[model samples]
Target: MSAALVLDFGGPVLLTPFELVADQPGTPAYELLHQRGPLATAEQPDQVWEDLQAGRITERAYWDARAEQWHESGGEEPDIRAMIAHLYDPPRPELVREHARALVRDAREAGRRIGILTNDLRAFHSEEWIERIEIVGDMDVVVDGSVEGHLKPDPRLYELLAERLGVSYAEMVFLDDQRTNIRGAEALGIASVWFDVTDPDTSYAEVRQLLGLPPDGAQHG
Candidate 1:
């Protein structure tokens, strides 16, 4: 019997919000929004994460809405769609792309079946980011939040992925960057690894260790 592995999209293999705007000032998207009066206090950051996880919105809506909020705070409107297009425009970071590909190749060679369980909005569906990151080509099955109308922690999405993969929940190993999402998977009897893609406080070595892989290509015990 083959072990099934389900990987999260935004963190394990892609540039997270932190990596995307590392050089920018102010807090990252994971931070709590400061009470900036009524106009700037329309949405919470966690709500966006939930929406992403719940399949309530797409990535474009998340970013565009964020940009709108940022503009509203300054009482000026910025071209949010254009800005986001530029943000995701650059080439995929080589280190992440290489490592992810290597993992997939090695896992396949090891006879493990792999799939993707991502809470991506429809915006990400059409973005170059998908192709650049190679999500479409690598995974055996992908349960996209926007496409399926179900998201992480919903139980339905996990069931859908498991059903498609023809595996039981306990036979699956899931990985993600968010603790809440991990907890959700745990509830469904899936073993999980947390990928910390954000925070310079967390180095790549830490990520490697968490995944039970070494920085120098050695396998973890």
Candidate 2:
């Protein structure tokens, strides 16, 4: 059966600096936020980020809000806007996996619907960054957590992606590095591949099989 492949940005697509900023257990970023106050106990960082992605807050507003947290904690506030600008500008340090692109090409050529469902920051979706990212190029549907007002594990995000792809929940094959997100997709009856960006081959093997494509070849229609 033909399936819609829903790829994640943070892990399945490419790694970014934000991987640490997220609320991953034992991550230095998460630990730092905890030490910084507000982000630790507050309905914080993640929820605030969701609001930013949902368009409830502008980029400037997000910074201002975050700055307030810094002020309350009396911590040194790095100029994040400046950093975001530098990282996304020309000659950014992003590695586009060659194999991943081939898989996308093969899947599209075989008539499979491809979608990018990501829980990404605002800067990552800027026009300049989007232009540079090839994975987003071949996607039939693109849904961002910030734009959807929902994140993975919430089920709403998957529902929104399904709506965009015009596919049933069961028809979507999702790939994400986070097991929590993978489990979320699984609960929705979506076929899922738990990707470990560190050891991607093991995950890609499952993705290839799910897409009904050969391990290393152009999938013919």
Candidate 3:
């Protein structure tokens, strides 16, 4: 009665720039303002964040618009994009790396099969970020959203992963930083752990305990 484990990459294993926006106060809300001008006061920050996340507007477009608006308003400032980049550039959090690799390690020692389930774009596949990470056991399968064009929160993605692993949804354990993603897996009868991601001090040992794995197999920092 071995278990199956699926891990999500974003928030859990990587620090995205959008998550660090609050850290950069000097950067204009829109990159265009610094490059060309300032943004109208009516434009909301949340809207900008969404547009950036969805890739609705190019970073350069936003910066250019900001620069124009700021200049028209007679505000003097530097380029916002460069300033924000310095604050929120994506970097691998070592704690995330350590524990994520450990999660794979623990699952292997518990005699469980391992795989990765992540929402990513073409770059993630092209860059081989999945292959770069060292998992303790062999990754039996990979269900990436960008490759399949079917992202998570869609139960089909989870189903596809289970099919490739040759396991029932009820037999799999899903780990994700997002609660919505976790709920999606649960709806399909997959056991789940809501990884806080930023903290890295998750109760993953409890998951091992539930699987009846030896305590020594679980790693704690």
Candidate 4:
């Protein structure tokens, strides 16, 4: 059986929402953070974000708090989906990471199953905008927590992906940006790579090695 390559949607498959907002200053997303507070601004360190990174708070709790703060700042209803829409309305293909796209292409060409396991695809993005994302359609499977009603670290979510992909946990290679999620996959005997957003190339290289694919720029043979 072919091994499956499963990736997290946010930081692995695309430039994280935080990175998108930071890269495009003077945009509505940047202005939302600037006006609201330093939830994302580097100059003004955000304790909430730090806590989330430290694993002191759950990802859901972090977003819930941000939604409340956004509403209090006169943005809109206290829903994370509303906040995500304001930050990433158009959802252009440019939001996807080039390396991620390349990796997926190579993995598919190698005859390996590719899947996206995300906590908030439907929750954070609109159906119209999601349709505009071509990379998402390329996946062999997409297991979304919002749709499944089970988030990462939940064994059932991982099990569901394995079942859908028709692969055993040991036959799957998972990549995610969150340490907690990585640990969860590791606990299930799945080979997991922690995608480092700061240095995506290294992470992709590791994934390539795990998938037994040729190194970047090397001949496929």
Candidate 5:
């Protein structure tokens, strides 16, 4: 049976600024990086991140909350926009993408459905960024957490994706870097691939093999 390929945008398909933090953990550039990701610190829950993704909280509001949290922890006043800007205002480079793009092209050409399910509504929905990424046009569906008001691990989001893809939940092969998100999809009967997202070759190779596609679909992939 032809299956729908459901991919998580950030870590699985392409690396983002948040995942890049570990590389420069001790530098001046990395100090505010600690205030990144869904859970900025170990003690804080991901509630604010969820709110940001779900459109319940504005971007500025989310940062304000982070700032308040920092003060509570006895950290001095933080430059919230500086950190947010560092992530948002970058030349977004690809960690790995060519093979993934080829797979999308080939799969679509062969009549299989493709979709991206991400907590990244902010960028993918934006005209400029979507054009920059170049896969938005190729995808049969794009599920943005903010637009949908439902983030991943929420069964409703998967249901919406299946509806949009015109496929059953199980017919979609879901791939994500986070284990919790993988388990969430699995709970609803979707076969999930736990991607080691930081390592491009391994994760991409596994995805290629799983989809029954040739090794390195792109010329340089």
Candidate 6:
């Protein structure tokens, strides 16, 4: 059986929405974050975000709280999707990580089927915005939770991706920034890597090794 590579969309494939907002000051996202005050910021740590990271709170609950906060602050519809659209309505290719693109290309060159298993592609992005992302088009398959109604750590989601890629769990390697999701994949007998957003190159190197591709700057046949 051939090896396959599956990646989570948010942190592994693209700069996260928080990182994007941080980079672009004077934007609505930036303003919203500033107004929210201390939610995942370096200067002022927020307990809610900490709870989310510590697995005390669900991802959906965390975002639902943020949506209510956004609405209270005079923002649009009190939904996580509304917040996502507000922050990323006009998606740009620059938001896609260059290293991720290279990893996908290398995997393709190495004859591995590539897939994206994301919990919120359609939930967080519009059709037009999704179309603008060239890296997504490079994937052999994309199984989205918004469309499939099943999110990871759900075994069914992993099963769906494996089914689409025509590979067994053992024949695939998965990468995700969230530990819970990583654990889920690992439990299913899939080799999984935790992508560190802080040091992406290291994660990329690990992925390359897992896929049996040449290391960065080494020759590839």
**Highest lDDT, which number?**
4
Worst ten-residue run, lDDT, model 2?
Answer: 32-41
Question: Model 2: what TM-score?
Answer: 0.67
Question: What's the candidate order when arranged by decreasing TM-score?
Answer: 6, 4, 5, 2, 1, 3
The digit string of per-residue lDDT tens for model 3 on 74-111 reads 44554443333343334233414554556667777667
lDDT of 3 at 80: 47
Candidate 6's TM-score reads 0.87
Report RMSD (Å) for each prediction in the order shown. 6.7, 8.0, 8.5, 3.2, 6.1, 2.9
Q: What's the CA error at residue 55 for candidate 2, in Å?
A: 25
- Per-candidate TM-scores read 0.66, 0.67, 0.60, 0.87, 0.68, 0.87
Collision pairs in model 2 = 53-146, 54-146
Displacement of residue 110 (Cα, Å) in model 4 is: 1.0
Which of 3 and 4 is ahead in lDDT?
4
Question: Candidate 3: what lDDT?
Answer: 0.58
lDDT of 2 by residue, 1-221 (tens): 75787888755666543443454446333343442322233434466655644546544455556545544544344555434343344534354556677778878877889998876545345666676766676788888887777776778988888888999987777887666677778888889997864568888878988879788554443
Across 46-152, the per-residue lDDT of candidate 1 in tens digits comes to 56755644656654565667666656555235545444444456545552545665566656555667788887634343556566655457788878876888767
lDDT of 6 by residue, 1-221 (tens): 43999999988998776766776577555655652322255656667766765667766777788788778877788889988777665778788888888888888888999999998898888888898998989999999988998988889999999999999999998989877788889999999998877778999898888889878756543
lDDT of 2 at 162: 89
State candidate 3's TM-score: 0.60
Model 6 residue pairs with clashes: none
Q: For model 1, what is the error of residue 22's alpha carbon versus the real structure, in angstroms, after optimal superposition?
A: 2.7
Better of 1 and 3 by lDDT: 1
- The residue ranges of model 4 lying beyond 4 angstroms of the native Cα positions read 23-45, 219-221
150-193, model 4: which lDDT tens digit per residue? Answer: 99989999999999999999999999988888988999899999
